[model samples]
Target: MSIELNEADLVSVSVGGAIAHPGFPGLPAEPYRLAADGTPFLLPTFGGIVYNVSVGDRAFGWAADCIHPGVSIKGADDLKNRGLNVFSCLGNTAVVMTGQAQGAKGVVTGKSGRFSEQVIVHFPVEVRRKMAVGDQIVVRALGTGMEIRGHAAVACKGLSPSLLKALPKKVEDGVLKIGVVATVPAHLVGAGAGLTSEGGSLHIQTTDRAEVEKAGLSSLRLGDVVAIENTDSRYNHGYLRGALGIGIVGQTDGPRAGYGPGLTVIMTAPKGELGSFAAPGTNIATLLALEP
Candidate 1:
Protein backbone atom coordinates (compact mmCIF):
# COMPACT_ATOMS: atom_id res chain seq x y z
CA MET A 1 0.00 0.00 0.00
CA SER A 2 1.16 3.56 -0.66
CA ILE A 3 1.47 6.16 2.12
CA GLU A 4 0.23 9.66 1.43
CA LEU A 5 1.63 13.04 2.42
CA ASN A 6 0.59 16.66 2.00
CA GLU A 7 3.32 17.31 -0.54
CA ALA A 8 1.57 20.14 -2.33
CA ASP A 9 0.98 22.02 0.92
CA LEU A 10 4.69 22.17 1.68
CA VAL A 11 6.77 25.21 0.73
CA SER A 12 10.32 24.88 -0.56
CA VAL A 13 12.54 27.92 0.01
CA SER A 14 16.24 28.72 -0.26
CA VAL A 15 18.53 28.87 2.75
CA GLY A 16 22.16 29.71 2.05
CA GLY A 17 25.43 29.59 3.93
CA ALA A 18 29.18 29.42 3.36
CA ILE A 19 31.32 26.38 4.11
CA ALA A 20 32.47 26.73 7.73
CA HIS A 21 35.86 26.34 9.31
CA PRO A 22 36.31 23.63 11.95
CA GLY A 23 36.22 25.17 15.41
CA PHE A 24 37.88 24.50 18.74
CA PRO A 25 36.11 24.93 22.07
CA GLY A 26 38.78 27.52 23.07
CA LEU A 27 40.23 25.31 25.80
CA PRO A 28 43.64 26.28 27.15
CA ALA A 29 44.97 23.93 24.51
CA GLU A 30 42.44 24.41 21.79
CA PRO A 31 41.62 21.65 19.26
CA TYR A 32 42.48 19.00 21.83
CA ARG A 33 39.65 16.98 23.38
CA LEU A 34 40.08 14.23 25.92
CA ALA A 35 38.48 10.90 25.27
CA ALA A 36 36.29 9.16 27.85
CA ASP A 37 39.40 7.21 28.83
CA GLY A 38 41.26 10.48 29.55
CA THR A 39 43.47 10.34 26.49
CA PRO A 40 43.96 13.61 24.63
CA PHE A 41 43.51 13.38 20.88
CA LEU A 42 43.27 15.69 17.93
CA LEU A 43 41.61 14.65 14.71
CA PRO A 44 39.40 16.26 12.07
CA THR A 45 36.07 17.12 13.65
CA PHE A 46 33.41 19.13 11.76
CA GLY A 47 33.20 21.78 9.00
CA GLY A 48 34.53 22.44 5.47
CA ILE A 49 34.82 20.00 2.57
CA VAL A 50 35.53 16.45 3.71
CA TYR A 51 36.39 14.57 0.55
CA ASN A 52 37.22 11.24 2.17
CA VAL A 53 34.09 10.33 4.20
CA SER A 54 30.45 9.95 3.19
CA VAL A 55 27.09 8.74 4.56
CA GLY A 56 27.49 4.96 4.26
CA ASP A 57 30.63 4.60 6.44
CA ARG A 58 30.56 3.21 9.98
CA ALA A 59 29.72 5.76 12.65
CA PHE A 60 31.76 4.20 15.43
CA GLY A 61 35.36 3.03 15.96
CA TRP A 62 36.59 6.06 14.03
CA ALA A 63 39.71 7.92 15.17
CA ALA A 64 37.89 11.22 14.95
CA ASP A 65 35.18 12.65 17.23
CA CYS A 66 31.88 14.15 16.09
CA ILE A 67 32.90 13.71 12.46
CA HIS A 68 30.53 15.25 9.88
CA PRO A 69 31.09 13.82 6.42
CA GLY A 70 31.04 15.88 3.23
CA VAL A 71 30.59 19.67 3.52
CA SER A 72 29.37 21.61 6.58
CA ILE A 73 27.95 25.10 6.01
CA LYS A 74 26.58 27.91 8.16
CA GLY A 75 25.38 31.47 7.76
CA ALA A 76 27.57 34.35 8.94
CA ASP A 77 24.93 35.81 11.18
CA ASP A 78 23.87 33.84 14.26
CA LEU A 79 20.14 34.17 13.66
CA LYS A 80 20.49 33.38 10.00
CA ASN A 81 22.61 30.34 10.80
CA ARG A 82 19.78 29.06 12.99
CA GLY A 83 17.47 29.58 10.05
CA LEU A 84 19.83 27.61 7.82
CA ASN A 85 19.94 24.86 10.41
CA VAL A 86 16.20 24.71 11.11
CA PHE A 87 15.06 24.98 7.51
CA SER A 88 17.52 22.60 5.82
CA CYS A 89 16.03 19.10 6.17
CA LEU A 90 17.47 15.72 5.38
CA GLY A 91 17.25 14.83 1.66
CA ASN A 92 16.94 18.49 0.67
CA THR A 93 18.93 19.48 -2.40
CA ALA A 94 21.99 21.66 -1.92
CA VAL A 95 23.90 23.49 -4.64
CA VAL A 96 27.26 25.21 -4.71
CA MET A 97 26.58 28.84 -5.53
CA THR A 98 30.22 29.92 -5.76
CA GLY A 99 33.82 28.71 -6.26
CA GLN A 100 35.26 25.98 -8.48
CA ALA A 101 32.34 23.61 -7.89
CA GLN A 102 29.75 26.16 -8.79
CA GLY A 103 26.38 24.58 -9.60
CA ALA A 104 27.40 21.18 -8.25
CA LYS A 105 24.61 19.49 -6.28
CA GLY A 106 24.58 17.64 -2.97
CA VAL A 107 22.13 16.17 -0.43
CA VAL A 108 21.49 17.46 3.09
CA THR A 109 22.39 14.66 5.48
CA GLY A 110 22.49 16.18 8.96
CA LYS A 111 22.93 19.17 11.29
CA SER A 112 25.76 19.65 13.82
CA GLY A 113 26.88 21.40 17.01
CA ARG A 114 24.55 23.75 18.89
CA PHE A 115 27.19 26.46 18.89
CA SER A 116 28.27 25.81 15.30
CA GLU A 117 24.67 25.58 14.02
CA GLN A 118 25.72 24.09 10.67
CA VAL A 119 24.00 21.87 8.10
CA ILE A 120 25.90 18.85 6.73
CA VAL A 121 25.59 18.05 3.04
CA HIS A 122 26.84 14.98 1.18
CA PHE A 123 28.44 15.51 -2.25
CA PRO A 124 30.38 13.27 -4.56
CA VAL A 125 34.02 12.92 -3.53
CA GLU A 126 35.10 14.68 -6.74
CA VAL A 127 32.64 17.50 -6.15
CA ARG A 128 33.82 17.89 -2.57
CA ARG A 129 37.43 18.02 -3.69
CA LYS A 130 36.55 21.08 -5.74
CA MET A 131 34.87 22.78 -2.74
CA ALA A 132 36.59 24.97 -0.18
CA VAL A 133 35.87 26.76 3.05
CA GLY A 134 33.85 29.95 2.49
CA ASP A 135 32.22 28.68 -0.69
CA GLN A 136 28.49 29.44 -0.71
CA ILE A 137 25.91 26.64 -0.63
CA VAL A 138 22.21 27.16 -1.02
CA VAL A 139 19.77 24.45 0.08
CA ARG A 140 16.26 24.19 -1.32
CA ALA A 141 14.88 23.66 2.16
CA LEU A 142 11.57 21.81 2.49
CA GLY A 143 9.87 19.41 4.95
CA THR A 144 9.19 21.60 7.94
CA GLY A 145 5.46 21.66 7.33
CA MET A 146 5.13 18.11 6.03
CA GLU A 147 2.30 15.97 7.35
CA ILE A 148 1.50 12.32 6.78
CA ARG A 149 -1.94 12.37 5.28
CA GLY A 150 -4.43 10.04 7.10
CA HIS A 151 -1.83 9.40 9.78
CA ALA A 152 -2.14 12.17 12.29
CA ALA A 153 -0.29 10.33 15.02
CA VAL A 154 2.89 10.04 12.96
CA ALA A 155 4.47 13.47 12.90
CA CYS A 156 7.44 14.23 10.67
CA LYS A 157 10.40 16.37 11.69
CA GLY A 158 13.01 17.47 9.18
CA LEU A 159 12.19 14.71 6.68
CA SER A 160 11.74 15.68 3.06
CA PRO A 161 8.81 14.32 1.08
CA SER A 162 11.14 12.57 -1.37
CA LEU A 163 12.95 10.88 1.50
CA LEU A 164 9.69 9.84 3.10
CA LYS A 165 8.78 8.12 -0.14
CA ALA A 166 12.19 6.56 -0.55
CA LEU A 167 12.14 5.08 2.94
CA PRO A 168 11.25 1.42 3.24
CA LYS A 169 7.88 1.43 4.87
CA LYS A 170 4.46 -0.19 4.64
CA VAL A 171 1.16 -0.09 6.36
CA GLU A 172 0.71 -3.17 8.48
CA ASP A 173 -2.36 -3.57 10.67
CA GLY A 174 -3.05 0.15 10.62
CA VAL A 175 0.51 0.95 11.73
CA LEU A 176 3.29 2.54 9.68
CA LYS A 177 6.09 0.01 9.76
CA ILE A 178 9.51 1.34 8.78
CA GLY A 179 12.75 -0.52 8.39
CA VAL A 180 15.63 0.48 10.71
CA VAL A 181 19.19 -0.67 11.24
CA ALA A 182 18.79 -0.57 15.01
CA THR A 183 16.41 0.31 17.80
CA VAL A 184 17.83 2.44 20.63
CA PRO A 185 16.19 2.23 24.05
CA ALA A 186 15.11 5.31 25.96
CA HIS A 187 17.76 4.91 28.67
CA LEU A 188 20.51 5.16 26.05
CA VAL A 189 19.14 8.45 24.72
CA GLY A 190 21.60 11.10 25.83
CA ALA A 191 22.71 14.61 24.81
CA GLY A 192 20.34 16.93 22.91
CA ALA A 193 17.43 15.78 25.07
CA GLY A 194 14.93 18.35 26.31
CA LEU A 195 15.77 20.32 23.17
CA THR A 196 13.76 21.13 20.08
CA SER A 197 13.63 18.30 17.54
CA GLU A 198 13.20 20.61 14.55
CA GLY A 199 17.03 20.56 14.23
CA GLY A 200 20.17 19.11 15.84
CA SER A 201 20.55 15.50 17.03
CA LEU A 202 19.95 13.19 19.99
CA HIS A 203 22.94 11.06 20.94
CA ILE A 204 23.13 7.43 21.97
CA GLN A 205 25.61 7.28 24.84
CA THR A 206 28.56 4.95 24.36
CA THR A 207 29.96 5.11 27.87
CA ASP A 208 29.06 1.46 28.33
CA ARG A 209 30.71 -0.32 25.42
CA ALA A 210 29.13 -3.61 26.37
CA GLU A 211 25.64 -2.14 26.28
CA VAL A 212 26.22 -0.70 22.82
CA GLU A 213 27.30 -4.12 21.60
CA LYS A 214 24.34 -5.75 23.29
CA ALA A 215 22.00 -3.30 21.59
CA GLY A 216 23.42 -4.22 18.18
CA LEU A 217 24.47 -0.62 17.50
CA SER A 218 28.23 -1.14 17.50
CA SER A 219 28.21 -1.37 13.71
CA LEU A 220 26.01 1.67 13.12
CA ARG A 221 26.94 3.75 10.09
CA LEU A 222 26.33 7.40 9.44
CA GLY A 223 22.94 8.01 7.75
CA ASP A 224 21.49 4.75 9.09
CA VAL A 225 17.87 5.14 10.07
CA VAL A 226 17.13 4.12 13.68
CA ALA A 227 14.21 3.79 16.01
CA ILE A 228 14.31 5.35 19.48
CA GLU A 229 11.92 3.58 21.82
CA ASN A 230 9.88 5.29 24.50
CA THR A 231 10.79 8.75 23.31
CA ASP A 232 8.55 11.59 22.12
CA SER A 233 10.25 13.77 19.56
CA ARG A 234 7.22 15.42 18.01
CA TYR A 235 8.22 18.76 19.54
CA ASN A 236 11.27 18.04 21.66
CA HIS A 237 13.54 15.10 22.32
CA GLY A 238 12.26 13.73 25.60
CA TYR A 239 11.29 10.48 27.24
CA LEU A 240 7.69 9.30 27.24
CA ARG A 241 6.49 5.81 27.95
CA GLY A 242 5.23 3.93 24.88
CA ALA A 243 6.50 6.64 22.59
CA LEU A 244 8.47 5.81 19.46
CA GLY A 245 10.72 8.00 17.34
CA ILE A 246 12.56 7.46 14.08
CA GLY A 247 15.78 9.33 13.28
CA ILE A 248 18.80 9.21 11.02
CA VAL A 249 22.32 8.72 12.36
CA GLY A 250 23.72 12.21 11.83
CA GLN A 251 27.25 12.14 13.25
CA THR A 252 29.98 9.73 14.30
CA ASP A 253 30.41 8.21 17.74
CA GLY A 254 32.31 10.40 20.16
CA PRO A 255 34.62 9.82 23.13
CA ARG A 256 32.85 12.27 25.41
CA ALA A 257 31.05 10.91 28.46
CA GLY A 258 27.54 11.90 27.35
CA TYR A 259 28.09 12.19 23.65
CA GLY A 260 28.20 9.42 21.07
CA PRO A 261 26.59 8.80 17.71
CA GLY A 262 23.88 11.42 17.29
CA LEU A 263 20.52 10.98 15.51
CA THR A 264 18.42 13.62 13.80
CA VAL A 265 14.71 12.95 14.27
CA ILE A 266 12.51 12.41 11.21
CA MET A 267 9.38 10.81 12.61
CA THR A 268 7.79 10.34 16.02
CA ALA A 269 4.52 9.05 17.38
CA PRO A 270 3.45 9.22 20.97
CA LYS A 271 0.67 6.73 20.38
CA GLY A 272 2.87 3.96 19.01
CA GLU A 273 1.48 4.30 15.50
CA LEU A 274 5.00 3.81 14.10
CA GLY A 275 6.55 0.34 14.05
CA SER A 276 9.79 -1.08 12.67
CA PHE A 277 11.40 -4.21 11.29
CA ALA A 278 15.06 -5.14 11.08
CA ALA A 279 16.60 -4.24 7.75
CA PRO A 280 20.25 -3.95 6.84
CA GLY A 281 21.55 -1.55 4.17
CA THR A 282 18.79 0.94 5.01
CA ASN A 283 20.94 4.05 5.06
CA ILE A 284 20.36 7.29 3.19
CA ALA A 285 23.20 6.52 0.79
CA THR A 286 21.16 3.62 -0.52
CA LEU A 287 17.72 5.14 -0.12
CA LEU A 288 18.55 8.54 -1.60
CA ALA A 289 21.21 7.26 -4.02
CA LEU A 290 23.78 9.63 -2.48
CA GLU A 291 27.18 9.63 -4.19
CA PRO A 292 30.25 9.43 -2.03
Candidate 2:
Protein backbone atom coordinates (compact mmCIF):
# COMPACT_ATOMS: atom_id res chain seq x y z
CA MET A 1 0.00 0.00 0.00
CA SER A 2 3.00 2.30 -0.32
CA ILE A 3 1.85 5.27 -2.38
CA GLU A 4 3.96 7.82 -4.20
CA LEU A 5 2.76 11.30 -5.15
CA ASN A 6 4.34 14.27 -6.94
CA GLU A 7 5.01 17.61 -5.27
CA ALA A 8 2.01 19.08 -7.02
CA ASP A 9 -0.33 17.17 -4.73
CA LEU A 10 1.05 18.65 -1.52
CA VAL A 11 -0.33 21.90 -0.10
CA SER A 12 -0.17 24.01 3.07
CA VAL A 13 -2.63 26.26 4.91
CA SER A 14 -2.68 28.87 7.65
CA VAL A 15 -4.81 28.40 10.73
CA GLY A 16 -7.70 30.80 11.06
CA GLY A 17 -8.90 32.30 14.33
CA ALA A 18 -10.67 30.05 16.74
CA ILE A 19 -14.39 30.16 16.10
CA ALA A 20 -16.16 31.73 19.04
CA HIS A 21 -19.06 29.85 20.57
CA PRO A 22 -22.08 31.73 19.31
CA GLY A 23 -25.04 30.75 21.42
CA PHE A 24 -28.26 29.98 19.63
CA PRO A 25 -29.93 33.24 20.59
CA GLY A 26 -33.36 32.29 19.35
CA LEU A 27 -33.83 29.49 21.87
CA PRO A 28 -35.97 29.88 24.96
CA ALA A 29 -34.79 32.11 27.74
CA GLU A 30 -34.30 29.13 30.05
CA PRO A 31 -30.91 27.48 29.71
CA TYR A 32 -30.88 24.45 27.44
CA ARG A 33 -31.38 21.37 29.61
CA LEU A 34 -30.30 17.79 28.95
CA ALA A 35 -32.15 14.77 30.44
CA ALA A 36 -34.41 17.13 32.42
CA ASP A 37 -32.18 17.35 35.51
CA GLY A 38 -28.90 17.43 33.59
CA THR A 39 -26.80 20.59 33.55
CA PRO A 40 -28.45 23.60 31.93
CA PHE A 41 -26.05 25.48 29.65
CA LEU A 42 -25.14 26.78 26.23
CA LEU A 43 -23.55 24.72 23.47
CA PRO A 44 -19.75 24.63 23.27
CA THR A 45 -18.90 24.54 19.61
CA PHE A 46 -15.71 24.48 17.52
CA GLY A 47 -12.01 25.44 17.96
CA GLY A 48 -8.94 24.61 20.10
CA ILE A 49 -7.33 21.24 20.83
CA VAL A 50 -9.79 19.67 23.30
CA TYR A 51 -7.48 17.88 25.70
CA ASN A 52 -8.28 15.45 28.58
CA VAL A 53 -10.80 13.69 26.38
CA SER A 54 -10.66 11.21 23.51
CA VAL A 55 -12.97 8.90 21.64
CA GLY A 56 -15.01 6.19 23.46
CA ASP A 57 -16.08 8.71 26.11
CA ARG A 58 -19.75 9.33 26.62
CA ALA A 59 -21.22 12.43 24.99
CA PHE A 60 -22.36 13.52 28.44
CA GLY A 61 -21.45 17.18 28.44
CA TRP A 62 -24.37 19.60 28.52
CA ALA A 63 -24.88 21.47 25.25
CA ALA A 64 -21.63 20.21 23.78
CA ASP A 65 -21.66 20.57 20.03
CA CYS A 66 -18.82 18.98 17.99
CA ILE A 67 -16.65 17.35 20.62
CA HIS A 68 -13.29 17.65 18.89
CA PRO A 69 -10.39 20.05 18.50
CA GLY A 70 -10.49 21.99 15.21
CA VAL A 71 -8.49 24.53 13.17
CA SER A 72 -10.03 26.40 10.25
CA ILE A 73 -8.79 28.19 7.11
CA LYS A 74 -10.71 31.39 6.41
CA GLY A 75 -11.99 32.54 3.00
CA ALA A 76 -11.66 29.01 1.61
CA ASP A 77 -13.47 28.59 -1.66
CA ASP A 78 -14.41 25.32 -3.33
CA LEU A 79 -10.93 24.64 -4.69
CA LYS A 80 -9.14 25.54 -1.46
CA ASN A 81 -11.66 23.53 0.50
CA ARG A 82 -10.93 20.50 -1.65
CA GLY A 83 -7.19 21.00 -1.33
CA LEU A 84 -7.36 21.23 2.45
CA ASN A 85 -10.02 18.64 3.08
CA VAL A 86 -9.57 16.12 0.25
CA PHE A 87 -5.82 16.24 -0.16
CA SER A 88 -5.00 16.16 3.55
CA CYS A 89 -4.75 12.65 4.99
CA LEU A 90 -5.13 11.42 8.52
CA GLY A 91 -1.83 10.84 10.33
CA ASN A 92 -0.18 13.59 8.30
CA THR A 93 2.18 15.81 10.27
CA ALA A 94 1.04 19.28 11.41
CA VAL A 95 3.54 21.87 12.49
CA VAL A 96 2.86 25.10 14.34
CA MET A 97 4.67 27.64 12.19
CA THR A 98 4.04 30.82 14.21
CA GLY A 99 3.44 32.16 17.71
CA GLN A 100 4.79 30.79 20.97
CA ALA A 101 4.34 27.14 20.01
CA GLN A 102 6.24 27.55 16.77
CA GLY A 103 7.98 24.31 15.77
CA ALA A 104 5.44 22.29 17.73
CA LYS A 105 4.23 19.25 15.81
CA GLY A 106 0.94 17.36 15.79
CA VAL A 107 -1.05 14.88 13.74
CA VAL A 108 -4.07 15.52 11.56
CA THR A 109 -6.95 13.60 13.05
CA GLY A 110 -9.95 14.61 10.90
CA LYS A 111 -11.78 17.45 9.16
CA SER A 112 -14.29 19.55 11.08
CA GLY A 113 -17.10 20.60 8.77
CA ARG A 114 -17.85 21.88 5.26
CA PHE A 115 -18.97 25.34 6.34
CA SER A 116 -15.80 26.00 8.32
CA GLU A 117 -13.32 23.96 6.29
CA GLN A 118 -11.55 23.16 9.57
CA VAL A 119 -8.97 20.44 10.07
CA ILE A 120 -8.64 18.68 13.41
CA VAL A 121 -5.15 18.27 14.77
CA HIS A 122 -3.98 16.48 17.92
CA PHE A 123 -0.98 17.78 19.78
CA PRO A 124 0.55 17.09 23.14
CA VAL A 125 -1.08 18.83 26.10
CA GLU A 126 1.92 21.08 26.56
CA VAL A 127 1.96 22.11 22.93
CA ARG A 128 -1.74 22.86 22.93
CA ARG A 129 -1.30 25.01 26.00
CA LYS A 130 1.10 27.18 24.05
CA MET A 131 -1.22 27.60 21.09
CA ALA A 132 -3.63 30.50 20.70
CA VAL A 133 -6.34 31.60 18.34
CA GLY A 134 -5.06 32.25 14.79
CA ASP A 135 -1.75 30.52 15.53
CA GLN A 136 -0.39 29.24 12.19
CA ILE A 137 -0.57 25.50 11.75
CA VAL A 138 0.88 23.97 8.62
CA VAL A 139 -0.05 20.52 7.39
CA ARG A 140 1.80 18.36 4.89
CA ALA A 141 -1.20 17.29 2.84
CA LEU A 142 -0.35 13.95 1.14
CA GLY A 143 -3.28 11.62 0.49
CA THR A 144 -4.02 12.52 -3.10
CA GLY A 145 -3.02 10.41 -6.11
CA MET A 146 -3.49 7.20 -4.11
CA GLU A 147 -4.63 3.91 -5.59
CA ILE A 148 -5.13 0.52 -4.07
CA ARG A 149 -2.77 -1.53 -6.27
CA GLY A 150 -5.25 -3.46 -8.40
CA HIS A 151 -8.48 -2.04 -7.01
CA ALA A 152 -9.07 1.03 -9.08
CA ALA A 153 -12.74 1.15 -8.29
CA VAL A 154 -12.08 1.28 -4.55
CA ALA A 155 -11.33 4.96 -4.09
CA CYS A 156 -9.05 6.03 -1.27
CA LYS A 157 -9.63 9.43 0.34
CA GLY A 158 -7.93 11.14 3.27
CA LEU A 159 -5.93 8.05 4.15
CA SER A 160 -2.15 7.79 4.23
CA PRO A 161 -0.20 4.87 2.71
CA SER A 162 0.93 3.84 6.15
CA LEU A 163 -2.66 3.89 7.32
CA LEU A 164 -3.72 1.77 4.35
CA LYS A 165 -0.95 -0.68 5.03
CA ALA A 166 -1.93 -0.97 8.66
CA LEU A 167 -5.65 -1.34 7.99
CA PRO A 168 -6.80 -4.92 8.42
CA LYS A 169 -7.49 -5.92 4.84
CA LYS A 170 -7.65 -9.39 3.36
CA VAL A 171 -8.81 -11.13 0.22
CA GLU A 172 -11.26 -13.96 0.66
CA ASP A 173 -12.22 -15.95 -2.35
CA GLY A 174 -12.48 -13.10 -4.88
CA VAL A 175 -13.68 -10.34 -2.56
CA LEU A 176 -11.63 -8.03 -0.39
CA LYS A 177 -12.66 -8.04 3.25
CA ILE A 178 -12.24 -4.90 5.32
CA GLY A 179 -12.66 -5.27 9.06
CA VAL A 180 -15.04 -2.86 10.80
CA VAL A 181 -16.39 -2.65 14.32
CA ALA A 182 -19.94 -2.16 13.13
CA THR A 183 -22.12 -1.95 10.05
CA VAL A 184 -24.23 1.22 10.15
CA PRO A 185 -27.42 1.44 8.17
CA ALA A 186 -27.96 4.25 5.69
CA HIS A 187 -31.09 5.49 7.42
CA LEU A 188 -29.20 6.09 10.63
CA VAL A 189 -26.77 8.42 8.87
CA GLY A 190 -27.20 12.08 9.87
CA ALA A 191 -25.39 15.41 9.63
CA GLY A 192 -22.52 15.92 7.17
CA ALA A 193 -24.80 14.90 4.35
CA GLY A 194 -24.08 16.62 1.04
CA LEU A 195 -20.53 17.33 2.15
CA THR A 196 -17.56 16.31 0.06
CA SER A 197 -15.28 13.44 1.00
CA GLU A 198 -12.58 15.99 1.60
CA GLY A 199 -12.20 16.90 5.28
CA GLY A 200 -15.76 16.10 6.24
CA SER A 201 -17.41 13.77 8.76
CA LEU A 202 -20.64 11.75 8.81
CA HIS A 203 -22.63 11.92 12.02
CA ILE A 204 -24.27 8.77 13.32
CA GLN A 205 -27.85 9.55 14.32
CA THR A 206 -28.17 8.57 17.96
CA THR A 207 -31.36 10.41 18.72
CA ASP A 208 -33.36 7.26 18.03
CA ARG A 209 -32.60 4.94 20.88
CA ALA A 210 -33.97 1.99 18.98
CA GLU A 211 -31.91 2.71 15.91
CA VAL A 212 -28.79 3.25 17.95
CA GLU A 213 -29.34 0.08 19.90
CA LYS A 214 -30.19 -1.97 16.83
CA ALA A 215 -27.12 -0.79 14.95
CA GLY A 216 -24.89 -1.39 17.98
CA LEU A 217 -23.59 2.17 17.47
CA SER A 218 -23.48 2.74 21.21
CA SER A 219 -20.42 0.50 21.40
CA LEU A 220 -18.47 2.53 18.84
CA ARG A 221 -15.16 3.87 20.06
CA LEU A 222 -13.08 6.74 18.76
CA GLY A 223 -10.73 5.47 16.05
CA ASP A 224 -12.99 2.48 15.48
CA VAL A 225 -13.59 1.77 11.82
CA VAL A 226 -17.19 1.38 10.71
CA ALA A 227 -18.85 0.66 7.41
CA ILE A 228 -21.75 2.71 6.12
CA GLU A 229 -24.13 1.08 3.67
CA ASN A 230 -25.67 2.96 0.74
CA THR A 231 -23.19 5.76 1.17
CA ASP A 232 -21.10 7.02 -1.75
CA SER A 233 -18.36 9.10 -0.15
CA ARG A 234 -16.03 9.33 -3.14
CA TYR A 235 -16.87 12.97 -3.87
CA ASN A 236 -19.93 14.23 -2.00
CA HIS A 237 -22.02 12.34 0.45
CA GLY A 238 -24.87 10.83 -1.50
CA TYR A 239 -27.29 7.96 -1.46
CA LEU A 240 -26.49 5.12 -3.85
CA ARG A 241 -27.81 1.73 -2.98
CA GLY A 242 -25.13 -0.88 -2.33
CA ALA A 243 -22.46 1.78 -2.06
CA LEU A 244 -20.12 1.37 0.90
CA GLY A 245 -18.00 3.78 2.96
CA ILE A 246 -15.44 2.92 5.60
CA GLY A 247 -14.74 5.64 8.13
CA ILE A 248 -13.29 6.21 11.59
CA VAL A 249 -15.30 7.50 14.54
CA GLY A 250 -13.50 10.79 15.09
CA GLN A 251 -15.64 12.78 17.54
CA THR A 252 -18.70 12.63 19.74
CA ASP A 253 -21.39 15.10 20.68
CA GLY A 254 -24.40 15.23 22.91
CA PRO A 255 -27.95 14.84 21.62
CA ARG A 256 -28.60 17.43 18.96
CA ALA A 257 -31.45 17.90 16.54
CA GLY A 258 -29.57 16.33 13.60
CA TYR A 259 -26.12 15.45 14.91
CA GLY A 260 -24.43 12.77 16.96
CA PRO A 261 -21.08 10.99 16.89
CA GLY A 262 -18.86 12.18 14.04
CA LEU A 263 -17.16 9.79 11.62
CA THR A 264 -14.33 10.89 9.41
CA VAL A 265 -14.26 9.32 5.94
CA ILE A 266 -11.16 7.31 5.12
CA MET A 267 -12.07 5.07 2.20
CA THR A 268 -15.16 4.88 0.04
CA ALA A 269 -16.54 3.72 -3.28
CA PRO A 270 -19.71 3.30 -5.27
CA LYS A 271 -21.58 0.03 -5.65
CA GLY A 272 -19.52 -2.82 -7.08
CA GLU A 273 -16.35 -0.87 -6.53
CA LEU A 274 -14.98 -3.81 -4.58
CA GLY A 275 -16.20 -6.74 -2.59
CA SER A 276 -17.03 -5.28 0.80
CA PHE A 277 -17.22 -7.10 4.14
CA ALA A 278 -17.26 -6.01 7.77
CA ALA A 279 -16.44 -7.42 11.20
CA PRO A 280 -15.33 -6.13 14.58
CA GLY A 281 -11.72 -5.73 15.75
CA THR A 282 -10.53 -3.48 12.90
CA ASN A 283 -9.89 0.12 14.02
CA ILE A 284 -7.35 2.87 13.75
CA ALA A 285 -6.44 2.40 17.39
CA THR A 286 -5.58 -1.23 16.75
CA LEU A 287 -3.88 -0.52 13.43
CA LEU A 288 -1.78 2.27 14.91
CA ALA A 289 -1.21 0.36 18.16
CA LEU A 290 -2.62 3.20 20.23
CA GLU A 291 -4.93 3.04 23.19
CA PRO A 292 -8.55 4.02 22.52
TM-scores of the models, in the order given: 0.96, 0.79
Q: What is the C-alpha lDDT of each candidate?
A: 0.88, 0.66
In model 1, which regions exceed 4 Å deviation? 27-29, 114-116
* Worst 10 contiguous positions by lDDT, candidate 2: 13-22
lDDT tens readout by residue for model 1, 12-37: 99999999998877657667788778
lDDT of 1 at 206: 94
Best by lDDT: 1
Residue 91: error of model 1 in Å?
0.8
In terms of TM-score, which candidate is strongest?
Answer: 1
Question: What local lDDT score does residue 117 receive in model 2, on the 0 to 100 scale?
Answer: 55
Worst 10 residues of 1 by lDDT: 110-119
